[model samples]
Target: MAPEPEEKDGEFVSTGSVLRQVLFGLVVAFSTLMTGFTSAWPVVLPKLQENPRSFNVTDQDVAWLVSVQGIVGMCTSLLSGHMVEYFGPRKLLLINLFPTFGLWLLMAFTSFLSVLYLCRIGLCISTYIIKSFFQAYIAELCQAKIRGAIAALPELIISVGVLVIYILANFFSYEVVTALCAVPFLPLFFLAIFLPESPYWLMRRNRTDDVKASLQRLRGQRENVNNEVKVLTRTSKVQVSAWSQIHELRKRENILPILLVLSILSLREISGQTALFSYSVYMFRQAGVEMDAFLCTVLLGCVRVVTTIIAVPALDRAGRRPFLIGSSVICGTSQLVIGFTLLMEIPGASWVPLAGLLIYVAAFGLGQAGIPWILMGELLPTPVRSIGSSIITFTYCLLMFIVNYIFFWLLANIRLGGTLCLFAFANVILVIIAYFWLPETKGRSLENLEVAFVKRKRLDQNDHDSNHEVTIELPLS
Candidate 1:
């Protein structure tokens, strides 16, 4: 690795460290590309439903196939969160590759509906574990100054994966696509082996030398990482039982961050991105778009990738709060345009939904799709990071399953226009909450954030003591 980049006036002045971090992030983020493949695989399900190539399947079966990952994900997320805390991310990630490869192999060859359901469950385990841990891993790896940009890489790569799978599906059989998904794992395994473990995790286990060595590798061999090691020593000193960590959540300092992250993630689900991407083709057809729905879905993927590429780099510069608020506004407006255009039955407006979808995907890709996950790492304190993240991940998957399971019903009961308008209204709520309450995490170290909360708790206690003293001093009231 190159030497650590220089810091000038508190900003990174060279690309060497940032480049190294991004490279590591991208390699680890390849796991998330599998998430994209699984998410977009539903686009091909309708075609399979038309033919039932080798297995007998129904619309209900297809819905189960599409939504079952979320159920399995909820369970695995809790396990993986604990696993990440115990074994650390690097080992857990390497162990994850075995199941991921095996599941893809099964997917490539399976003909039975039961076996395919089993494969989806395995896929969810591999990918969602990565989803649950990688953000925490990357946040530990990179500095706060450039953390937002580096953390956002996974979202960008996921979009690219979606676009790639869409293009491949146009010309290849589902089996071929399934087989090809396994190929990336070979490189991922080799690349992941060389990446350093999280120094914070190392510190928690009393591996002081290993923590320094890991910090050296992450910061570059030429750099002196002693200061960083000292910070890790201070911040990661708490070693407690998992139940004790869970009890920590009852405190104001810990629970407030959990609430912040949970609210953000809940709002992310309510924004309908998961349901939108999962059912993009069906949604396009329902909107009466004259363009080919598959083609429009592919375009949506392309636009998502391009916009995320452009927008992610600006995240650290513009800060998370503004990016999220701006992205929410555009998303709401685009949904409204689509809803109005469809509901009014405007003549020659068959093209409107496609146009609106492109705009929505672009805006959603800009920040909404990525930032909440990034916050999962930034906001959660070390003492409760694992449990807090697990709880949030469980809720996220549950909401995802609910939204996906009920999406068609929502469209049937209220029409596409009304369903989209409901999603738009969600954005409105997100914007209001975010503007007033979301703290600016840009350029703030994770250690500093933890200390800030501790200080706030102290101040609150001091105020309470002062009030008690005043009550004692009063004669009669």
Candidate 2:
């Protein structure tokens, strides 16, 4: 991989080019909008179960609609890395949306539970494919200094998508709401056609002229694109074989980051937050909330959006490790607060879960939400990036499916308060672990971050040697 940009944080800060990079990110990031809605659609499932005649589905049928998406997503994520690397990010993103558009067409015209299953399958499969590309895209296009804000773009887009779905599901029939979901892909996909392909990918193909043009567009006409061009050329040659990538994991640097990526992805997805989002209405109903469940869900979506907006700027300025630690502590505390309030049956504190969840998600938005993704792309070398992203995203989807499938069982078997408390305790543990393992990547180049781990490991070994010599000296005396 190329060395860190000399300007460090100057990629966007000093240039007029940031706007072009931002626009490019927004277009690519649009898929997360689809992802947000797909995540939100589960909330509608409980309603479907309540009134089967309108949808011709059973509780069992409704249950499969969600778990199946995760299963499909897991499978899709594994392949997405190769798809993007070979076919290219721009084309993969465009083609992948067809399945999403087609699925939504099914949803708008039919109410069969089977169609919902297909809708979810296409939605999730397309999403992970887009995500693999987006991660690579953001890492390559933007400078390190501003990468955090761009990387966090998904969280904000997703929140907006969820809020839109929640509100639409309230007034519209399922069919109409689905059609609304499908509508955006048409314009977004076309807009992407005009956008520059990843300059790195272009360079990898030895398409030097295209790379030059792409850099000109992204870095601005007046800015010097030649140095950026050299980095891409140097980094993309003679792509590393898959065997070498697998071998790379044996190294301390490779292993540590991947492990950190795995832990962070697993913790968030399996945290029952999706269940928290999906079953918000049911959760409130079961808890005897007097307010409208739909309205409360809309409120939840709003909280997510607002907090993510707050997080975007801080990602670059405050650094990544703090957000991960702070978000975990706050989320853990919020979960604890919710658990206590519910178990104690506090009078007139029906709003406690709402308040706690608000804080939890806000904290999550500020750090945990964006850092894992940034690390996923940054930590892995270019040769291993594709496979590494695939593994992490695949693990993420599989865990998400498992959590969604079993969350209710946990709530029933252990009680909502107990289940939440467990997640709370987990966040506390993660906060401790993350403090030691999570490297600070904010405003630093990906190559520099990787080398930092290697340097730390080297220093640690030297310290160990010094200690061993002292022990030997003591024995001689």
Candidate 3:
């Protein structure tokens, strides 16, 4: 038989390889379903608000039902990372699907606040687990050049789910909406049944044959499987344990990238996009929208979905930093306009707020929604990616919880304009941070980024040395 075709060197790997694309698409669908269901609360919030007693709850208690989910998700993010590494992404995801489906079923029938709280917490934990694992898995599986585009799949699916849920909620009962929310999970559960385990995980475990099979399935060729396996094996060997890996990352050399990732993730939350998602219905209500709150929320979700579609093709083309800085500016400006409109009580201010809100959502979809996860995957060296990703996600989730909690309190006490103005100021700060610190990773290979950081650090040190030498010579003279 003729020798197997040699793997191409420096060739572009197609993310659209039939099997990989299908697998990625399936993962995206599951992610979207999870996110969509979580976000669907906004559409259902008003009904829960109106009939609090139907669920044997006060409005304040019902608010906690939503709040608790975020709180639990935030708390679980760190643990979820370890769990993913230990059990593997496929297994963790399959486990999460159970509670994810169960929670919706519970919501459909529960009459007690305690039961509702428990189910929400369960859903939150499941979400945290799946999101952390899915992100890491996608990063590990995709070739560096196309990783960002593949990473964007989850966010795209999320928007789709949001749009679907919103539409369904507008025309259906809460029970029907919950049932519909659970439908996506059915396909996901079935599809996942036959999906291969993550090859990186298999390599790490020294399951050579299994690793080769996974690589063949994911990459659709056997020629490069051994090389890929070797790289992953070397990386895995270096990361013997999570804590040791994390400690290694604390060195001064790693500080810049670490700080950059943390800052981006932090600013992502402080930018107030998620707060808006959690409170969209309430904000629209404050804007003097007389329609049903659920309908308004569906409108907002539709806007988000449409804008996200507009963003996909542009993401790899526009580059990360440009979109981030541009979105920050747009988001900040929109918030300022909306805040001032509320403050001045301008006539037709309702439309002004509505327009501002739409702009804010659009900007968020264009940048902050997916970019942080993409950056997290790209910023770290292979040896520490898992631990580093966990830390970044932990910071992100913690900040999300704090923001959402404070958001509810702020909305209760502060005027709508003031609340938005605060977020605008936060976005302005993020723009400055992005300008000075966040590097452009677009089109750069992961190995190239690793080298770039090292080279940058070395260059910085050399400049410092030259400046010191010049100062010493002048003083001696």
Off by over 4 Å in 2: 1-7, 10-15, 45-55, 111-116, 205-209, 234-237, 346-348, 456-477
lDDT of 3: 0.68
Q: Model 3: per-residue lDDT, tens digit, 46-130?
A: 5566555455556677567666756676677667656766777777777878556667788767777677777777777777667
Q: Which candidate is the best by lDDT?
A: 1
lDDT of 2 by residue, 163-237 (tens): 888888777775677778888887887888877877877876678999999888887888887866765665564
Q: Decide which is better by TM-score, 1 or 2.
A: 1
Off by over 4 Å in 3: 1-9, 12-19, 45-55, 111-113, 206-209, 233-237, 252-255, 288-296, 412-414, 455-477
Please report, in order, the local distance difference test score of every candidate based on alpha carbons.
0.79, 0.72, 0.68
Candidate order by lDDT, decreasing, is: 1, 2, 3
Q: Write the per-residue lDDT of candidate 1 for residues 419-444, one digit (tens) a residue.
A: 99999998998887777656667777
Top candidate (TM-score): 1
Pairs that clash in candidate 2: none
